[model samples]
Target: MTDQRPQYGELATPEEQRRAAGLPPLGEIPPVPPMMQLSAPEPVAQAPNPGRSRPVDRFVTIGLLAYGLVNVVITGLSYLDLPTVMNESMKILGIDGEFSNFAQGKLWGTIAAALLVIGWALTAALAIKRLRRGKVAWWVPLVGAVVTMAVVSACIAVPMFNDPAFMAYLEQMSGG
Candidate 1:
């Protein structure tokens, strides 16, 4: 014999329970409306292959990383040559002089090189993290370069301004 107990949902009303028990309706009780249709809501639109390839963002991020690599190498090479650094630092200051503090100037160059390397590494790491998370990361390298170079510029400035020649030139210009 078929079991009369409710087979499924616990929300069965008294009438449903009774119907499951196969009792005739007492005094014309209205039939329970058919259970509401429950289909899954339309699936959220997702980016194509969210678990797979995100090629465009990856390409741009890598390209930007390559650009940063080139810049860091060129800047490091420039800082390696002391004569060029001496001339260029003065040139940047608009002064016809060389830094007498060769050791101190080289120290600044070293600091700049370190900053460039560190900045490149950090940008690469951040970009890789973003790419893995499927985020746009093309701008990280550019922003990293801008921030690192600003600090490097300040580092270069300290020795430049501390030089007697640079200070004299500034005094000469300011009429002090």
Candidate 2:
């Protein structure tokens, strides 16, 4: 007759358990305890990654630094003379002087240049603080910087190219 016994697993040979329990070699058996139960606790939940969304803050910081540097350079040129600042701005913008003189030009030029510096510094400081805290404004400071830069660029370049009245004011300031 062929030997017949219940198998537990690969590790438990059919005859080994039968022999250990003092049962018949082939087919005789009685009830046995469960052996394959796991003792590990269930897994705990985890928090999601916070940095995966809205990944543009670093670029904003870099752009702020660049804008600050450009404004500082322009402000230094303004100190030299109206002609130098005007000539350089014009060349950079690929436009010609429509200014009657430098007085009005200098007034708005200085204002815009100063705003650029101040805005850049403020925005950079806020950005660094936010980064340190592991937070971002996502609206106020970021939008404010972008809008301020646009206004400053317009104030510096538009008058010399498209706005004749503002240009005349600048030329007058230069003469005075």
Best by lDDT: 1
Determine which window of 10 residues in candidate 1 has minimal summed lDDT: 31-40
- Candidate 2 structure quality by residue, lDDT tens digits, 1-176: 87565445546787886777677988554545463243235644432233553357545555656665676677645633554566665557544553354665676777776776677667767766665555654453556567777877777664355456445555676895
The stretch of ten residues in a row with the least summed lDDT in candidate 2 is: 45-54
How well does each candidate superpose onto the true structure, as a TM-score? 0.64, 0.42
Query: Per-residue CA lDDT of candidate 1, range 87-118, in tens?
Result: 77678868877777677778887888888899
lDDT of 2: 0.60
Regions more than 4 Å wrong, model 1: 1-54, 91-94
Evaluate residue 164 in candidate 2 and report its C-alpha lDDT on the 0 to 100 scale. Answer: 66
Residue-level error in angstroms, candidate 1, position 172: 2.5
